[model samples]
Target chain A: MLRTYVDMNLVSGKQPHAWDLGEFYLIDRIRALVPDIDLTDDCAQIELPYEGTLLFTTDAAIRGVHFPEDSKYIADGGFRALAGAVSDINASAGKPLAALLALVIPPELTLSEFDRFLSGLLEYSRHSEVPLVGGNISRGDRFGATISVIGSSNKVVTRSGARPDDLVVLSGSIGGSEIGRMIISGEASDADIKSLDSEIIGTLLYRHLRPLPPLGLGEKLAAIGATSMVDISDGLIADVEHIAEASGVNIHIELGKLPLYPGVTEIAQRHRIEPAILAAESGEEFELIATMSLKDAEELEKLQMPMTVIGRVRSGNGFVDVTLNGEPIPPGFSEGWKHF
Target chain B: MLRTYVDMNLVSGKQPHAWDLGEFYLIDRIRALVPDIDLTDDCAQIELPYEGTLLFTTDAAIRGVHFPEDSKYIADGGFRALAGAVSDINASAGKPLAALLALVIPPELTLSEFDRFLSGLLEYSRHSEVPLVGGNISRGDRFGATISVIGSSNKVVTRSGARPDDLVVLSGSIGGSEIGRMIISGEASDADIKSLDSEIIGTLLYRHLRPLPPLGLGEKLAAIGATSMVDISDGLIADVEHIAEASGVNIHIELGKLPLYPGVTEIAQRHRIEPAILAAESGEEFELIATMSLKDAEELEKLQMPMTVIGRVRSGNGFVDVTLNGEPIPPGFSEGWKHF
Candidate 1:
């Protein structure tokens, strides 16, 4: 039987002799990474969300761009891309329900490596509870995966809802992702991350590969009535500008009040750069910047979420101003990720 | 004032001066092609499908892979890719509700070219009735797009439902897409497409760029209770094998009865290949293949759809047999598309 034929090739990391790209052949590849995928009927079918509204978002991760394409870390690319996609739903305070993945599998990659990539993707899909209900795979020159996530929330939030004087909140510390990357790439180490406790190093690497989105926190955000919110994938300085522009308001971040991730200051020292600047420019942190009333902010704090008031919204014409102890920091804002 | 800043560079094919990748900046680019997108709140919000079950599918068109990336017909790539994506929904006898596009823009492309690309994508998106509700764009070495379509249907059909003795029907003719590619790439000519009537050539080329799915025909197929269905994307011969394997039965095709598009016979003759083989090997036709009971198929024939019974299902284990006027064809079944 074909099942016996394919099982022989899987363990040795060799392709099935005379393997062909057919619909049935792919089911076996997907099953190896995710054993519990409900074989979708042509495409994935899900019950319509009746309790709330649909919130759909998509993101892509490319080899050699979004992540280190080192063969050893190729699997991380899959996990990271899936993680970044789900962040958009949480940014809008929506709970993710399902995801459809489209994989561009390069002929050059060994079947073994591609399996790892799928595992990396499956790891986060399971953890985030966004089941990979269906997907498509095709041969291409390079490896990439585009993840489309469908989610829903009764209380929808947008970047255009900020009001003047709303307390700007940061969901968690920044720069952890960047430090994780540096350690992985072997770039820094005076207070080198690898030299630290194995536990700390593992934590940093895990965060880099799969930064967990603050799950279930979206409900609290909506319950407390977040005025405006955006995730920190584009860095703090750049994303605040998004809020300011969309809401037609000005935002001033107290640079000193910005919390740095645990190893960020140490890594910044090793890299010999201003830790605050590093925090301000780090992208893909997957944290959140939300603006809300001070009373609501206090209530959220009691929930023990790792959130801090890093800035304040002001009435003005779409300008983001960062300050250190009430003094404007500088002239040029640190560059964020530019997609074009 | 901010609107004026971005609009000044729109027509002249120049990047917006001091252009920064922000959520607001993307809104302007998207608005250029689709003038009426109700700017989404964090993500596109669509009402849950209340009438039927949801069918979600995704596909990717990579540069120089799915279509030619020549600058002149770059726009066609967009239209073609979007068209191919919607094929899956129709295959399942479902109605497309919405689509999400993820664009990978290359810096080497001009602003005018990018605008043209968006227009191309929007053109077919409009034609297919699958609105572009939301998408993401990122910088990459080559241009690409990943499209995910969400559809719905009251009666669902899959490839696994074929029963022995069922009549196999094809929605439209094959080999048109292959001919279009030949014309566009200037590969073949004779009783050539170019020498033909401008309108006929135009129609053929249009079919190549945007092969219309037999829209709403799925509703009719479901009405008469189609047992198994798939779109003729991977060529008829290969797709027939899909139905056979999925349904655990055999499919026998009468090659003499295989319908050929208007110019397919001429183009295949010009290329010095048998017309039937070319038709069997052709991909991206976007026609539907369905198997139904003999009585239901007779009812479907009276509905005036461009469907013809070209084959039948038999009791067996996943073997596809092709016959020429009740005689075995040749030494090798013509090679269909092998994505890997």
Candidate 2:
């Protein structure tokens, strides 16, 4: 049946256009799921209508950019990429409404793999409870995924709301994703990996594979009048710089004050690598970094989730200061993952 | 600078994954474009509070499915595809607000060609008065363009509103696009093409290329008590059947009554093909197919723009009929374009 539908124009092997195979098949199946829609005539109708506040954000996962070519489970790669995009929206204190996923599948991928990728997307979508509303699927030269998520919130918390003397807070400890990715790349030995507790290592690998965004934390902080906030996508230090740049303030972090997972420090020590590298530059944390009144910070600490005051904001130029023992910590050449 | 950033990633060589591309680089560039985005928090902040009705629609344009591979101006092809998508929303008598275009660029396409493609998209977007709000970019195996458009409509005309005995109408002549496609495919001779009026030919080609959707026709018909309506994306006969199916009634189309462009008949005759194939099977009309009261049809006929009583609906199962010289016209094997 699939062979019958594959256009002869493509199968005749005139070097099928990029959209001929996997993505095309995916689109055909997906479009069938959508009911009739007519935009030219004013009479066209949709199955449902949009309601509530609309929060929108776009994220791109590019080949040789966000993931490795031979990496495990391309389907999982797509899932994690989209989840990260949605996490940005959730971090903004918004309730996810729907997502518009634009996928770019490479020619090397098979139709079955593409279908499985879509199945994975649907799986994540179902798990997240954010319906796939409407999006475009196009062909690209390489495997790529761009996700635009739309959500809603009653009162939004912004990165700019942080003020001087506000207490900085982080939702979770970092460094698991970086370590897990290293293990996936086979750079780290099994003995090196097994030295850590199996469950902790498994948790680290899972976190690296999929970092769950603190969904309700942003809204809860917003409701309690948290000043400013941001997601730690480009490590804690780098993302804080983003807020500082946008809000025109300086963020000073105490390295000793930083939080770490159970095995991160030991792994860093064993490798003779700076724990700061794992703690600071490692990406895909998906944790909310917020600035709040010291009193509000104390109140939030009473919650079940972990909250740490790793830094403070001060009136100055947009600079990020990492201090240990009241002295400046030199920054690295690569400041997290800068897409630009 | 690009080379240096590329070196920062752990993944190197042909097997480099998306992560090797240096996350910081992409984030920085994408961030420059979206300076106002609050990424430090969960969920993005909306510029405006939610108000009024929100319209949404998605469309796909594939290489062999929608356009020929060796066509002139692939960039225009992109523009035309977007126009077609937006036209569906306009058909709802809605003003186009914004569009999130998800593009899949084939691997073989150069960066320059990609830039030209973006220019074409921007051109169409600027002319249509719809900002390219946000979308995803990815690499794919083939050339496919999919776009999701958002618009606003004061009133909506649904396809299920047609009453029995309402007169069927079309916004423009049928079958021009089929002729245009045939001409492009080298079926028409030079003399045959020359003998046709150039203006009509231009109109046909333009209709095939970029259809001027009758955006307000549905609302106007609805205002005057028009019943059910649909856009003629599929062939006239097939699309009306959709209306019949939606409305739970039978429709009878008067074959001899179809409005045709000036040069369509001669071309069809020269090609030794039935005009019905051109008239009934060819899609991309972007014209409003409507059912209205006889009084309303009369009033519409007196005014400018084409409107004809092509058929009438009867109380029955969702069956469609075509009549020529008072005889039933059998349905053709190829109803319209189907992806799968």
Candidate 3:
């Protein structure tokens, strides 16, 4: 019987490329028991209509790079990684079907510690209904996780489809997420973030730590005829440039008209930062910026997520211009955060 | 224009979750020019036929873990990773459609070195006709890539489908791959592996380094009604257990009948190792093992790749007993490699 094989203590020969026995499928099976998930963009939609277009995209979170190195934040790292991947699908107006995670666990991480991180992923999968189908694991010197999501849809909203005269709309506020990250890292202490307002500080921290993408908004925007769409992973300029370049159109975002998280201005003021620039330059918001016709924008603004009109598309070749308040920004204005 | 933003020298306030500017999308765009790929298992096949089954699987190669730590092996790591992924699709008798990569690059690696690794993946994608559609990148202290491949097929051969009286088959020789690994690591010096015929060493090294799983053989076996199939990643006993456990039957391999790689016994002789055990426990040999009716096996034996009937399925509860010649294997028989 195979039971003998498991109990034998005889030395097995060299195991060059294999992990120790029994560890191979255990993590995946444990996660499968927890739940399933999804994360995606298009191989095709317009060109291969009704063939069931598949949307593909990948996102990553690295300890000491994407987040702090504290093991306590491991689960948050898992949640953040999944949110970033699924938001791409939301941008495409597609439902996430499955997510594959690649995790590099440093030697110091106990199996229990790693399971804590996996819990974050499992919780999100159950919530999003995007099952964690399977992933690969490797031992390394640092902790890193990368997730690839595949989705299916009858239609897709693409970055390349924005046109001149389209209105830019944001699904929610910005600047909160970046500030939230600061609070979590202890960089914004009671001298600033906590002193101003605990509720506000707590909200920002929560947004940064355990954010979920707006569940079903992209489809609504797509249904109402959005010309282009992008999830706000990076700051305004960094991510929107993808749409601007791909669409071959100029974009002009008005800083004054930007929708901002409530306490963002106070935080910017305390730090001697320009509030408008902070809002435009913030990253990790995971909200959405979409372009559509004025009528469609009007319909969108009335939706429950508090969508706001922020900019307009213009005819140009792959560039975006901005106005602070019907005037060009100061020459030495702080540049936006470039979240690649 | 956004050009003004890229040229400014002002310091960024903070970048908690973003990579430095201008590095975004460049790698994906470059690899997109090269090609795309795929890698899979069942979300469904038999349960949901006529409505395209999506097969999913992930494989990873980490520096110092799956392979040696030399930077020269980077490209081969890429190739091996992709091959390991696509081979899963082959086992399901499915066509691979697209592949997604999640890469963690060490901080010291230069862009050119990284591009060399990318070229390895791109080359295989072109050869296999599996497009490298999209992937994520992050900087860390260790290099790793996990690939997730999705495939489509109307019919799939599952591991749970084997039954009593089914004959087990090996698609090609084994044990050679482990030896090949030894030669590459320089562990098997001229006093050992190099003492063999140079052609045999070259063939084995080639087999270990750039193994492309017998591409079309799996589908052919499925077409001939192969009852169960699995790609030989780990050695014979470890992987066969998966089928036995899944199918609720016993498997038995006859050591005398195994199609040994040329020179395996010669090399095993030098090390005072059992040749039969060496053949049984070698890992990372991506050849396949399949079970089918004896009549179907007879028809499959005529294929071009030289399939060999080495074992048989018996009525038992997931235990694989083996015999060397007509005698049972020795009680202290060497155990198989435990590749996770």
Error of 3 at A180 (Å): 0.9
Clashes of each: 0, 66, 21
RMSD of each: 3.6, 6.9, 7.1
**Cα-based lDDT at residue A209, candidate 2:** 65
C-alpha positional error of residue B240 in candidate 3 after TM-score superposition, expressed in Å = 0.5
Q: Which candidate, 1 or 3, would have the higher DockQ against the true structure?
A: 1
Query: lDDT per residue, candidate 1, A1-340, as tens digits?
Result: 6667567777666675322444456667686567655443456777776778788888889887787778788788888888898989998889988888887766566656777788888888878888888887766656788999888889888888999989999887888777777787777653576556777777777777778878777667878989888888878888888889889999989989988887778778777887888888878888888999887887886778888899899999799888877788884667885321
Candidate 2, CAPRI quality class derived from DockQ: acceptable
lDDT of each: 0.79, 0.67, 0.71
Tens-digit lDDT track of model 3 for B9-105: 2334321121232345335435455533211100101111224567666677776777657767777777888888888888877777777777776
Q: Please write out the lDDT profile of model 2 over residues B1-340, one tens digit for every residue.
A: 7555445432444322332343344335444544432334444343432344455666666555566565355665666767777776765555666666555545454433444455566667767766666555545455556666666555666667777888988777878877877776676777678878888888777767666676566567766666777777777887888788778899888878888866788889887876765677778777878888777777795457778778898888788887875677676644574321
Cα lDDT of model 2 overall? 0.67
Candidate 3 at residue A293, lDDT?
89
Estimate candidate 3's alpha-carbon lDDT, on a 0 to 1 scale: 0.71
Models sorted by DockQ, best on top: 1, 2, 3
| Candidate 3 local Cα displacement, residue B291, angstroms | 1.3
**Which digits, one per residue and each the tens of the lDDT, describe model 3 over residues A139-186?**
667777777777765567788888999998888788887777766766
